[model samples]
Target: MNEPEEGAAPDEAATRDASAPGGLSRRGLLGLAIGGSVAGLAVGAGAGLAGGVALGRARAAEDAHSAYGFFGEHQAGITTPVQDHLHFASFDMMPRTDREDLISLLQDWSYAASRMAQGLEVSATGAVGGSAEAPPDDTGEALGLPASGLTLTFGFGPGLFENEEGDRYGIAAQRPAGLERLPAFLGDDLDPQASHGDLCIQACADDPQVAVHAIRNLSRIAFGRARLRWSQLGFGKTSRTTTTQATPRNLFGFKDGTANILADDAAALRDHVWVSTQDEPAWLAGGSYLVARKIAMLIETWDRVRLSEQDAIIGRDKGEGAPLSGGDEFTAPDFQGTAIDENSHMSLAHPEHNDGIRILRRGYNYVDGNNDLGRLDAGLFFLSYQRDPAQFVSLQRRLSTDRMNEYIRHVGSGIWAVPAGVKPGSYIGADLFA
Candidate 1:
């Protein structure tokens, strides 16, 4: 990905009616009232933009610090430096929506996404530029905010091609052979509502609101064509994708993804992460498969366990995150030694034991308030990209007997065929549609 261009602040609203035409649903109109305060800022800009030159400098500094280009050989989020916050959403096409609706939705989303990545408004006549009598083209929330290193990655779920309705998009045969829903795994307390969708967009940014803004505006654009199925807000990324990053910790209080694939590791990426041209299905040649698993942690239960037991279960020391075999965090584990448990998470997930197979992990920690039991409803929103879905499947199957399973439950799961990146004039997924 090339360096990102400096852009302006953000804005957008939600849609109410699933069948609302042109995305001007009742909810969207209600947003115009809710955003009245922000709208005032747009009106006052001509007289005196707040902080004026200072704000412009700040935006410029933000661009230098974090922004990433949206167009690339691969989508930005996968190998781009992991951001601090995430807003991941899944959507389903509205009933009776035709191929044209899907196409237009992608076109609109692409245009808006390209603008938002540069920190620009959703359109040239954005938030306050439209006619006074009409609802604004862009929502007014991110008026002065910088791009915040935001990256938008999109994917197509199996249902997008063919669901119970049968080839609704006339592209069922185009679906990759490996794009089917993930097979059921042990310890899965799956929630039907959160598991799968026709489409998904992963928005990652240094600013939480910026990420949320991207999803909100995109959803509004989909008002009549598609509707959100479920979304997740996450912070404190659990993994790193570049060498400059330090290993981050998970909700489990252990350093996670210590040996994750680095962005510069071309050989590993080719062998494991990105789909190749020689692979089946030409449209997804430069793309890869994505698998998401919402793993809920038993916080109270794990917190009460002895420190020694925790260390044994994870096969690493909590303080320095070193392998129990007596080496630093990055040292290759001596699986031959008796120090680490055979069923430990580290041992089970290590590439050495899995025929050198690896997946690029970009997980995040999430907390969704508290449950009725007064316990925290939180865990890891695990995300991984691989050359083929089977790479993840093989690794996950080996984890069936993982020691960590006792303290976590897989509540949601999904698999998507992420397409190759878009060119300047084309929309995402254009190759498959063609």
Candidate 2:
């Protein structure tokens, strides 16, 4: 498989009744009160605006069904329930962007994300009602929609800390030891355009419109500060992060992430996923490193393979997704017999053979239309969160000789240090800047 060109245009909400007992929506109240404060400028105007913002936030916090908390020890998207849709975008800082500009952008992004997470618009002025000459704060597509469990995760790439010439943002010294460029692996036809970025944003939600809207507004916010390097739209989550979620299928038509690290597995998360304060730069505490691989599945080739051969390659029954050596879906695979090949995908990726190392997978399936040769351009966009970059590096190294390599090609790759979650009053990566 050949690496395609870098540029690709990639591609949600609940409805709340405005006429309910409350009469006005929480966001509507906020807009009116805040807008009133600006117009009045009389006694207690400051108090009115503050009270309105606080009240709006309180209402948002109470929305556990549709909103994931923005302020937490770790970011939401990593451990949160895998949403049905995804809009992942990587960006490169503009040529003369300074450290302060980066900080400002992060602050603006964090504030906007917080509001959006609560089913509110990016700004108080919203998509309309702002000055006629100014662009709308929000894109307006997600208007009147519920938050849809929206999550916005941010990460900093190795290039963000330092460039080839030298430290660009003067924060190279603060870079986490685990944040490094991934080594070229076997059978990797990596595309330069989609490979690396200075930063990335992963926006996910149950509603496809919500996911796309989040990224679109965020991109608008990043206008001059940064430009999109690459983006991907994904549907059909391939992994289950929470026990409540059922395992989803990938492009290979097999159940994927049957043995993934669950969000409730606290011990597993601490050991393999979340970065600890003791790991290195304390700023990354509670954060995790993300490894993204654009694995292009040769659908035409795989579809032609015999059924038995496909089963042997994946080591799982296509119908039940149970291991050949297993009894049921959740049953542990018994690698003792001839049931599973030594180089099968399951055997190589299993934690037992990988020194008990497992990563939290939040992958998705993508179909980007037909390729140049008329073959379906589709595959699994593999995303994994790990405590250290080395965890993924070591794991991928073992899979280099796996039998499934022939059916898929690694075309795009990226590694980013996902900083700790934002505090209510702080921006993402604020500790690093401090």
Candidate 3:
């Protein structure tokens, strides 16, 4: 987030209500300076703004960002009033790299994210739309974009700080709050309610470090998204050894995101995605659809278990997402008989693709450190996309106690009800209950 012209301390109430760019309430901004003293948050802000941080500004040059609105506004229903132009738009990006064919890769990334944005509905930020008109085509299949330099995924995280309201961090605060620490009970949420997720989708990558760079670039766009949270790493769930797919590769060694965004079929695109429209504000529309998650894995403890037992927990081969008995990674499980072979990855036991939770999984992998020991400290920032959170929340909840529950945890979570879009001349929060 950019700095506020004025200064003040952090305020949760203001951020929750006026967190949007040009959306942060002026009244709250003024109160920040005064309240900072009362609440014990004082770094001598710019005089009147609470949302911006003075310290962060003074820090070394970080990635610059520009948050707009969710572009596919006309296609869906918005959840707030529009003080500015409205549409399903938050942030989009060009690739970031010094690699060969980087420009082409960047364009491809933009195209992919933009195409996906077409089907998305207006969400947080200063958007304009409020319907389900956003599009649903994958970058790999739809735009034929390669992961070499393109960011197949784009994302942010749940509020990592105490004062954060959605994606708006206290850019004005001299001292930012919260660390990038994964919560303990952050997994087990299978299907999310209207506003809860914990997923981070990723496949395998030849150069995990390169993937980190790509994610950072994509994160710059997400960081600009005034409505979404940002994270340093995301968990992946690919059965393969490479990382180019949006389908998440879980730490358990599973193939995720198989049924994510719509296939490259023409008919499916129109039915599932959307584009920005005049009905939305000028800035919205042409924005990407969003999927947020709060997934966690039992890495340390899971590692301690025997491989054979692990297979029983997930009901499949960890390396290929195939049944322990042998089959393709993408094959549907029978999930009928007890068929609990000593090593079979049972559908009744694990819900990787079972439990009927159809989400467009797109998340990331993360590592906290070696935990000062030999074990690798890692997990996922699980996220998923859906037309409606209500339709999926039940699906995920069913997996809360899935057989795999023993392999993961559910530490932190909350859902932000994303709206469709809005055109100019509207105000946000108009639909607090709409």
Superior by TM-score: candidate 2 or candidate 3 = 2
State in Å the error of residue 92, model 2. Answer: 0.7
Clashing pairs in 2: 12-207, 14-146
lDDT of 1 by residue, 256-294 (tens): 999999999999999999889999899999999999999
Against the true structure, candidate 2 reaches a TM-score of: 0.86
lDDT ranking, high to low: 1, 2, 3
Tens digits of per-residue lDDT for model 3, 149-245: 1113322223321223332222122111111222223253443331332212121223344344333323322221222222334333322112343
Candidate with best lDDT: 1
The 10 consecutive residues of candidate 3 with the worst lDDT sum are: 79-88
**Per-candidate count of clashing residue pairs (backbone under 3 Å):** 4, 2, 135
Return the TM-score for each candidate structure.
Answer: 0.89, 0.86, 0.43
Q: Write the per-residue lDDT of candidate 2 for residues 1-434, one digit (tens) a residue.
A: 01111231100111111100111223222322342332321112121111122112222323436676666778889988899999999999888878877887786677667667756666555665454454454567777676787889999999999996478788999998778889999999999898889999999999999889988877777767788999999999999988888888888889999999998899999999988878899889999999999999999999999988999999999989999997988999999999999999999999899898889999999999999999999999989999988889888999998999999999999999999877655678999988
Model 1 scores worst on lDDT over the 10 consecutive residues at 11-20
